[model samples]
Target: MNLRVPTAWFLSGNRSDSNYTVGVNNTVVGFQESEDLRIAHDVITNSILVLIILGMGCGITLDQFKLHLRRPTGVAIGLLSQTVVLPFASFALAHSLGLETEAAVGMMVMGVTPCGMMSTVFSYWVDGDVSLSFTISILSTLLAFGTIPLNLLIYSGSWTDKQFVIPYSSILVLVGMTTMPLLLGIFIRWRLPKVASVILKIGSYAGILLVALSLVMLSVLYPFMYWASWKIYIAAISYPYISFMFGYVVSALFKMENFRRRTIALETGMQNFTLCFAILEASFSHVTSDVMSVFPLLYGVNVRTAGFVFVGIYKFMEKYGPKPVLTEEAHHLKHANNHRESFRLEDQQTSKGFLDSEAAEENGES
Candidate 1:
């Protein structure tokens, strides 16, 4: 097997003394490639750790989870879209694009992974249903063990010749990673709000820094992925957009309100790519793992970039777009927000007046 150093990898400045023979799949692949791969892998490992901590510290609360549960219908629909629609869409997309075996598996892993905490952040930004987003994220994560393995087995069965074992143990690790911190955070929020707030502040700063480092590592890795397999890039770019649209259509068909539909769309589109990376790394051979990582890295880049653009569009529409014809429920929520704003202003004015009177009293005494 000829293992050419991909043009992109070669273009990324040399960090080693070793020279690689292009197109030879020798056991001793170049140190440079190994070194780059190791660095990227380390970055991913660290980022996952940070995100786990961050998700626990700041991403959710037990109350938020319970609130979502109060309305099971919407949350159930979101879960269906996540576990059923997204994986099928990914499998179909990979098949249609003729992605490499490893790449196809990577895509399926990404599709099957739970809704990321970032979806809730986006939901809050867009005035979407935050409870729904949180609910979908938490429930999907809790159920990922069953859904992930089943989806992968169903979708990628054709591609692998060996009896590719789904590592149930690793799924346990996933459950622990996602749940332990989450429950701890909820506990902190409930009992020690001050401590939780401090943790949230620190976690946000650290998460941002680690995320920046991870992006840099991924950017370096991207060029090394095959130019010949341009289809992977096409798939990466299109997958999230399609997922978003699919969620909207499904939600609309279910006759959900507009905000709930948008919430489902964001949840469906944003997956836990970090978890995908962890699963592939743990389950596959080194070479196969490296190859599989390409799709996730590409997706991590594309989804967020595209999501941000969509978020901007959402914000613009909220501010300047024609008023949406509101249902009674929607009208009630709008009136509630307006009422809250008025109360806040009145409180501020009362505080200001009290402070002024105290100051005047002090001045008279002087």
Candidate 2:
């Protein structure tokens, strides 16, 4: 369950360098295939994914979800912003930027995938409404199962130029890989809370190591990738920052509270990279390898870096920005003090009464 994010100091370095090409042939493992390194990196990514699911599962609870139903408008707004608005925006960005078709498709897929596990972490960090964030994340992901295929078909309709067709066999791929695991995680969380908690904690620590390992790879890998990145964006790294500012500004234009604003910001900024990666792995074939049409695997690192950057930013912002109200915490502190005072007063009264009663008894006996 250890799925810590890869480190993202690279966020500030230069996504625009276009110096780092991520083509199909450009294995992230570097020039030499080094099966050992490839296996290690694969293990890290898989662990990161498992940890992410575990953390998300641990963050969720079924008991009080119904309470939010009474305030359906907010829920609706959160949902609409996520599933509807976000996908369209992602498409627009990719299309207008004139991204290669697969890149555009991949970016759009990232948008459609829904709020990430980090949304909960960022929500809590930014003092945003964690419950609402979790609720929005879960609902949007549930909705994605139906909407993603539709979006993919619509956007990539002409893929082989002969009205490209899906094998329908891949539906099983989507379900088995993404949807089923997610549901399994949720079921475990609901039915076996302690197990979920342990998995989630492990995932969190794993995520940290993943981030560290990613950062190290980027440092070692970038200088050699100059040949492949000829046409990709020189400004791709900055997109996350721009996206954050835009989402924050847009959320603020509405009358949202501090925490909700944080939720919107982080949710809006981070893409679900795993979804895009899974689709590329599943849908594309080896024959189309170089002309494979999907983006270079290096983009995965970019996506991870962006998500982690926002998480760190949020962790810092949570301190100065809005926070969850301490109603329960305050109530408990007050109750404890009241109980203590009551105990002290009762002890004093009992002691005086006992003393007076003993004197009276002595007088009577005398």
Candidate 3:
């Protein structure tokens, strides 16, 4: 979508500096009430989510997923990191920081949710195992159906007074939204490889577009939100890095390979904001939902920025670090060249021998 909503909201002569308040009521009041925000949230989030899912499917293959399907260790570790370790970390961080209830709940929701598509994007760029990333993402998403509601019940008891119910319909929407496009992309890859390749290139750019779209949506949704509080920023900055390290260290402890470690790290660190938003919309009143959304929106931006930093570091290392070994095809080509050189040497020796024999015969005749 365009930035017209935010621009119009800005130009409508309703701008007030005092509207930026720290209270949850003040921060999210405009968002809950704005028709523009509701529309933008639905349109922008869904579109971006679909594109991300499609891109993820385009990059992965059935062959690459064989290990996850069989052994399930990587998927198990990844799910544990996200569902168990990350959520506990999120709760601990938020509680220790003494954040407001809504903010704390937001962090927990982000921690409990599935990994975002941006993780897969980062994995691809950083030369991690894309298949492993996708596998972990899908498996975590499937498991979130159970773990998310359970987490909400467990962590939200102190935060929310209202009865929390798991909204199965919204969960189903998340499943369909994520899985359908993924399956379609996989089908295209299997059947129409050329088409899938083109789509995959386009999908790589989805991250940038989603970021821009989110900024616009947030601008329109909460034109007066005071995001300047150091508390939220502290949580945002610390959470992703902690989650990354947690995944990496745990994977290493479990004897995962380097590439899988990187993939798991990214997958664990990134949370699916769109899915979290959807759940918020389904489970709470507009006011409460809007208040909760601030956490995910801010977290999404910060985490992706960190992810890109990871990508840049990896690109630099790939360019300047030790070079990769030759592939099987390269080895075959080298062997063929050596064989050709040997045959040429043999021909030259035979020609010299024939010339010597001719010279000797001629001398004998003389």
Count of steric clashes across candidates, in order: 4, 15, 0
lDDT by residue (142-253, candidate 1, tens digit) is 7887898788778878577444455566556655665666667656755765565566545545544554555676566455553325778898889889988988888899
Model 2 scores a C-alpha lDDT of 0.51
Note the residue pairs that clash in candidate 3.
Answer: none
For each candidate in turn, the TM-score is: 0.70, 0.59, 0.75
Query: lDDT tens digits, residues 153-236, model 3?
Result: 787776775565556675667678767888898788667756666676677677667766776766556553334347777888
**lDDT value for model 1:** 0.66
Computed on alpha carbons, the lDDT of every model, listed in order, comes to 0.66, 0.51, 0.68
Per TM-score, the best of the predicted structures is 3
What's the TM for model 3?
0.75
Off by over 4 Å in 2: 1-40, 48-60, 69-75, 157-204, 214-231, 246-254, 287-299, 311-366
Q: How does residue 328 of candidate 1 score in lDDT? A: 48
Identify the superior model by lDDT, candidate 1 or candidate 3: 3
lDDT ranking, best first: 3, 1, 2
